[model samples]
Target: MIAEHAVPTSVELLRLDADSPRTAEVRRKVVGLRLAPGQQRFSGEAAHTLPRADTDPNRVPFAVLYRQTPVGFGIIDQRGILDEITAAPAEAVLLRAFYLDPEWQGRGIGRTACLALDPLVRSVRPEANEVVLTVNEANPAAVRAYRSGGFTATGERYLGGDAGPQLVMRRPVPYEGGAGDG
Candidate 1:
């Protein structure tokens, strides 16, 4: 059961467009969360450490939401559609990466981020059967939150950490505005 809450939370998920001031703000939040290290293959190098602006056509279309115009930001990239997933092949979207400015985290902001991306995922690929994400076991709170969000363990580990092991989880995605069974 989803166990819908009695009231909606403060975070509001909005699509980020190149013209919006949010494009830059979201980049700050990405680094604030320390999601991608200073230099990464996907995120970019020192000079381009900031999240790729929406104008960068080569980069993936990242959907970012804010608490308001620019108070906080959370971003989700559809990973299964990317190069890494192509190397293995899968019919799922990777929540890829997510982060909220520390002050904004633990306020269900992460969950709200997932919830916000749900519709966006559906919009792009109605055939999307699920979403896959990897969380460090060291991050106990994160594992618990994702479990509560209907994700189940896949008995898989990746990029072992000194803190603890990692696991891959998947959540069945419901198709949008469509009637059919997978």
Candidate 2:
């Protein structure tokens, strides 16, 4: 089943089903989506390496959909957090390889998806409190998008990225309490 959550900008993040025809379509389109010279490091192809249920049972890949149409892709995984650029807390999730199709860029899909990730990730990683990602400093556009979507720089820099130095960013998950508040 493709799990989805309503988000702003009429975009929803759907859990990618590797065996589904939809996944193939997204993959085909991803091959043609070009990223800016500095943003190529965040290719959707890298997202494909994240473990799925059939592979590791702990990682998840998501397809960004605009009105039920696939427009982007990303992955959220807890693995390698301890060894990745930043030492995220045990309850923190690593948002990796987030990329929007070139055709869908500049339409706010990226920011909307970033904001909507809280609920989408909670569906599987309910304990996750903060989502972390490292963006190449060279990719100012991405850094701007993420910052606009509520992520803040963590003052941590990693020079291991192929594109150059990367800055660590973190966004705390919004609290969702059950029942009425008032």
Candidate 3:
């Protein structure tokens, strides 16, 4: 189910189904710019390795991370999106890849995307005591974003083949019936 959340001055976020054409463009942004600067593991190989589940029910693309709407997009996973992270450590769902369009950055949209996550994550797993994710070590900006939004690093990383290293961070669930658990 695609979902949207509003936060006054903050950017409005939309979680889209994988089939959304917006997914392709968003993935492209991550591949072209978002992953450069030693912050991501998205080499040409990983980019091409995008899941066959674009139209599948199990996977959904995260909102275009923009001011009014996503100038680009990001991808988040539920339970089985990836083999390593979910299979090894074993978590229920994950806030996965984040991609931002250059034109839409530098205005707190990234932060908005980060903040919006808490509610969406909690809504699906109201009983979930924790929410977890894997991020590349090179992405310090993202690390900072997660930290500011109440996540603590577990001091662990997942290496996907030779794609590079990803750090795992988590936050404890705060509200049983958060701002939007409907």
Sorted on TM-score, highest at the top, how do the candidates line up? 2, 3, 1
Ranking by lDDT: 2, 3, 1
Clashes of 1: 0
Give per-model TM-scores.
Answer: 0.62, 0.78, 0.62
Show pairs that collide, candidate 2: none
Shift of residue 78 alpha carbon in model 3, Å: 1.7
Q: Write the per-residue lDDT of candidate 2 for residues 14-87, one digit (tens) a residue.
A: 77645788777765654454555545665544344533433756667777888877777777877645356545
- lDDT of the structure predicted as candidate 3: 0.54
Write down the RMSD of candidate 1 (Cα, Å): 6.1
lDDT tens string, model 1, 1-182?
12344222555555454556665665454444433332132223212323453433322444334435333333334443333322232446666444444444455556665655557666545456667777776666668767766677878776533345567777766666554323
Worst lDDT 10-window in candidate 3: 1-10
Candidate 3 pairs with clashing backbones: 39-138, 64-70
Candidate 2 or 1, higher lDDT: 2
Off by over 4 Å in 3: 1-8, 18-40, 43-53, 65-67, 81-91, 122-129, 178-182
> Tens digits of per-residue lDDT for model 3 on 11-44?
5455543456765555555444434344345422
